[model samples]
Target chain A: MSDQPTPTFISLDDAAAMTEGTRVTFIPGLQALYSEALKNVCFVKGISLTRALHPPMGIDKETGEDRQARLFELTSQTSLPTMFHDDERPRNVWIEQLALAERVGSPSAPALIPDDVAQRVEMFGLCAVILGEDGMVWNMRIMNDGPLSRKYGYNKTASAAAPAKVAEVIALIDARLKTQAENGSAYLVGDAVSAADIYWATMSMCVTATPPDIMPVTAQNQGMLKFFASNAKVPAIAEVLTPRIEEHQHYILKTYCETPAVLGGDPL
Target chain B: MSDQPTPTFISLDDAAAMTEGTRVTFIPGLQALYSEALKNVCFVKGISLTRALHPPMGIDKETGEDRQARLFELTSQTSLPTMFHDDERPRNVWIEQLALAERVGSPSAPALIPDDVAQRVEMFGLCAVILGEDGMVWNMRIMNDGPLSRKYGYNKTASAAAPAKVAEVIALIDARLKTQAENGSAYLVGDAVSAADIYWATMSMCVTATPPDIMPVTAQNQGMLKFFASNAKVPAIAEVLTPRIEEHQHYILKTYCETPAVLGGDPL
Candidate 1:
């Protein structure tokens, strides 16, 4: 396992007790790609956050539900990676979350969004490919959980088309990475690290297995992850997981992210 | 049929000739919900837009493809309702389009976003229920186009669940509307009209057919729309199309949105 130090995590009760600072609720595991990406954004930007577990991580055993109903009262939805900054309305959408991070980040830190309009558009577009509905991770979910799992309920025709759709997305990522590598740029969008880079680095876990050393997980989770990875490795999908793409994922993770993931679970 | 005057529409060729100011590409048909919503937002904000037809409207009969190809080149995708503001990058996503309207809207125009943080959150949440993924229109699409029509490829399980999913969303909308009406607020979220109100007003077309006078469509399109409406009126769906929801939609259309939709097409 990597020697990276584990980041501190506060319980929901502890996080809720703080009435004055920023608090975030996220799924506390490696497989929670959005959570990991949001956490990385905060880390890179040097934004202080009180992290608390959500859903399964914080479920009430007796009721088999979220321990806290207050989250629902606050955001009116059960989705995670939601942030509450002071008394501001809870930021639930990914784009909103990124905007919030950009706003609250330390002034000394590098900006996650490109200042140039063209580059900013390009960055948001690439991030959408990684995080938007029907993007790469979405297809990956279809492969692992079936299309209906998320309530999308596409027809058998679309269900059958998942592999091709995923293959197309992977090819797009591979082509982008190849071009960026040729230009000698380490980041996805422009000269500096952006939300696109961080998103891909974390979201890649859905397709390719992260080394246990880089992102240690519970043994049970590791097995579950392997199942998901295997389910996602259809022939078309396998063809597009190019070396350049994998290299970029690893590069971004090791260089920019918190290794060992700060996930408080036991190592596989 | 509608005593309401038809709005003027510029052809794509005409719109493209103008070299200055703001331009937008949108589908030129009654059934395009997002297009109608975006157009309404601009109309209410008093933002002048050079409207150009997209996709099937501008498709070449010989090749049966988009005549301009420039739209795909500009946005990297074929989806419509994209806006280009004074040499800025094209805004394609719904949220981005709304943000653009907010930015360029008349100085004295009422804000589409509520000034109160809680109301803003509530507004967005309601808007999400109407337009977000797995929201009302999405379910309407499933009812009309089948699950496989889009790239989402859900299984039979989800396909089977669409009616219930749609019913739940409708109930949620009905509940929200009922509460707002009880509070004597004409709008969905706050004291004044907001994006959420306009979004629901336009998006409601998917479930309920608009009067022919107000949104006159070609006879062929009228038949097609009837089919869509019929398909969407499954038992569970019909139960939630409460009278309050219908009245609210008509009220918003007549009071705020441009009558006859400025859709340059022929009357039914």
Candidate 2:
């Protein structure tokens, strides 16, 4: 119900052409969890970001080689959620982008990293565990990717271990949320919302199926979401993904993030 | 095998009572991948470490409460491969422990972290992907833990997704190793053996079953190894666990680490 203007999605050419201000190139479809998390951080911090769609890295038909996007020239990696601010080095890593958002955002906004040393350490550690290299979403990605790849008859096979790992991560988050609730805090790390909360709220899309009313996606993306949800319904994941976790995602999106997520030009 | 002295495993009480140099408490039996990695780091660095068996945290019969070990009080965590050096804070995290080894280790030893900034980043990033929270072994651990738990009729259920994740990690390692080999480097990162090499070499135990002759474990552990190996033989894992990966483990243990491994009371 917030009246925030819909984020305008621009072409990769326009994004690369503009050498001023903060520009973020993100993949706009179902696999937009990382992009969404970064956008939500900017949203909470009131940091203006020029949104651009990541160019597809498809094979070059004539050359018989892989086509490299202009984005790859800017950042060696060909991944979404890459941020470029002013003349600074492009930030492809999630933590670095979060740090950038914190650095340039409005001073009046809630701090993503807590002031207290202990809370800061806890926040960083939890964020790393949730969003870092081998963190929760990373594992969930493996779990989901394996089945998706196999279903398409790709050479890739699924890991029998990913679901349990996903479950373990869910259990950890649920337990943390429960403890925070018990301590009279609505957020993940401390009293106010932090990067951990945003990361969890958006990344939960990897596991939980968000209805169209809350997060509208194209029909193709809807099928993808269904696939992810079905894969996530294993006993290991099911046993720990408590209702509270889902509610927290809803609360974070409704209160802090742009509701009815304006991803990939979905109508407001 | 090198004539290096067998590492004497001390009792938990003796280890706790020691007020001395570097002391490492590790789970002795089958679940010793973490311990093995830490121990190998010390071995490569030629740092003397007093080995201690971590006290089990089983439930008490009369109180029906989970018994807390002295280790838990020191580190606030109930896991293996906890390192204590002098009066410094106990290190429960893998990266922290690696840093400790790098700090107190011999200068003559092959540096685990690369000297060049780019190589260092690659090494750390790869190490994280392998040993970090959701890295390779972590996913494999989930893969292995699921079936083991289910087999025992524990409250846990297996994730249908873990095996593919395990395979993906294996493919990553295999590809890295292959690239390194093709580039004429014997190790994972650069020309020298770095922490990345050691981590991949030891952590591969989670996926590849080491024979009793190479690394002697208890008879009970042998059974557990069998269970792990059987679970790890899925199509996903099988497709990627190339011979090169297995050979690297043997080479590291034989050339760098003390072998046959002097774990628990198993005579060398």
RMSD of each: 22.7, 22.0
In candidate 2, what are the lDDT values of residues B117-158, reduced to their tens digit? 335546665665566443466555565445333432223233
Best by TM-score: 1
Off by over 4 Å in 1: A1-17, A57-61, A64-69, A146-148, A152-155, B1-268
Docking class of 2: incorrect
Task: Compose the digit string of candidate 2's lDDT tens values, residues A16-52.
Answer: 6677888887665444777878989999999888988
Model 1 chain A worst lDDT run, 10 consecutive residues: A144-153
DockQ of candidate model 2: 0.02
**lDDT (C-alpha) at residue B137 in model 1:** 68
As a whole number from 0 to 100, the lDDT of residue B135 in candidate 1 is: 55
Candidate 1 - CAPRI tier?
incorrect
Measured against the true two-chain complex, the DockQ scores of the candidates, in the order shown, are 0.02, 0.02
Q: By how many angstroms RMSD does model 1 differ from the true structure?
A: 22.7
Per-candidate count of clashing residue pairs (backbone under 3 Å): 5, 14
Cα displacement (angstroms), candidate 1, residue A39, comes to 0.7
